[model samples]
Target: MMRSAALCMALCLAMSMAACQPGPAAPPQSAPTSSVAGPPADSAGGATSPAVTSPEPPAPAAPPALSAEAQAQLDQELVAAAKANNVPLVSELIGRGGNVNAKDAIQDSAFLYAGAEGFNEVLRLTLAAGADVASTNRYGGTALIPASEHGHVETVQILIAAGVPVNHVNNLGWTAMQEAILLNSGGPRQQEVVRLLLAAGADPGIRDPEGRTALQNAERLGFAEIAALLRGHG
Candidate 1:
């Protein structure tokens, strides 16, 4: 009986010690993993992951197909605009590819007709836009010839200063000075124009088919002042 009680007391002490001791920790589990391998990249929205961006499209080119009707309308407007001395409209047309030196059915470019009609502003504008100052009409009469023929001294002076040939003979074998002498229009400036042409190196002795010099034409037409001016230059 003593041995049995001793054995029971020893077994009860063993059970109490086992209950107080700490157990081995379960195997450490790996941290929750992400589906992707690397860290996320930054985005435009200030977010960790960014979206792909697309490229922008290019601009379209202007059209170049000009219709016949449109061209006719533009031509009419350009002619009228030139006649009216509408510098702004003329410049606009020229800027939009309109021809500043285009000739009409009468074989007159805008500049030629403008100079012929004494459109001084139009002449200047056309010249500034690259109009041919030396362009001749179908009759082979240049701007300077007509201007001088009509006794338009200012226009003639402009043409002369613009580098026009002062002695250009038209198809009728008449120089500007000869035309001035032959014409009986008797404008307010005929004598002055005759004198100007003579001063600008016009040969007073040049004869036409009738063998009449500019001085002879003046003499026949009774332009005493023009004749005197030519004689003085001679």
Candidate 2:
């Protein structure tokens, strides 16, 4: 009975020692996580920001519109300026929407008058402003005819280069070549005009209203140099 009592006391002492020992320490706390996302990775595994672009520029503004009366007045002014060899006024009027092919009461357009009168500055302006090359004058002749007749060599060259038909027959049924021979004195300038005309494919055989060829007219007018040029071309 003494031995049994002693064993029970020893077991109760062991249970009391285990309960007195402290429990394991609590687990270590982790840091707080961020809410924001990081930059995205590229195919090469590099971080890339969003692409930036510039705004597009605005288009050019169009010219103002004009009424019929206002436009007609501008065209008339342009024609007068061109006829008077007023280069600055012609350019300004053209910029203001003046028609280069608009005709005056006498059927004289800025282009026609400038070309016929050898006004090269005005002619160039009118040409650039869209002069009608095939348009005729009061005489129903191209600017080249009068230019050739007057021995305006440079004017003739400019007109021809602008695509004036060299063999075009005017109302008088005379080509520029015939007019150069029949009207001019066949001086050095006239000879050069004839040369330019022939080079530009003016037909020497095209007859006038009187049914006379340019070469025949030149021979009759005693234009030896021009006749020689015609014969050489033939």
Q: Judging by lDDT against the true structure, name the best candidate.
A: 2
TM-scores, each model vs. reference: 0.64, 0.76
| Candidate 2 structure lDDT | 0.91
Candidate 1 — what's its lDDT?
Answer: 0.76
Model 2 lDDT tens row, 141-225:
9999999999998999899999988888888898888889998899999999999998898888989888889888888989999
lDDT of 1 by residue, 45-102 (tens): 4437556788788765533556877765665566678878787887777555555667
Candidate no. 2 TM-score: 0.76
Over 4 Å off, model 2: 1-60
Candidate-wise lDDT, in order: 0.76, 0.91
Q: Provide the clashing-pair count of each candidate structure.
A: 0, 0
- Locate the minimum summed-lDDT window of 10 residues in model 2: 55-64
Which one is best on TM-score? 2
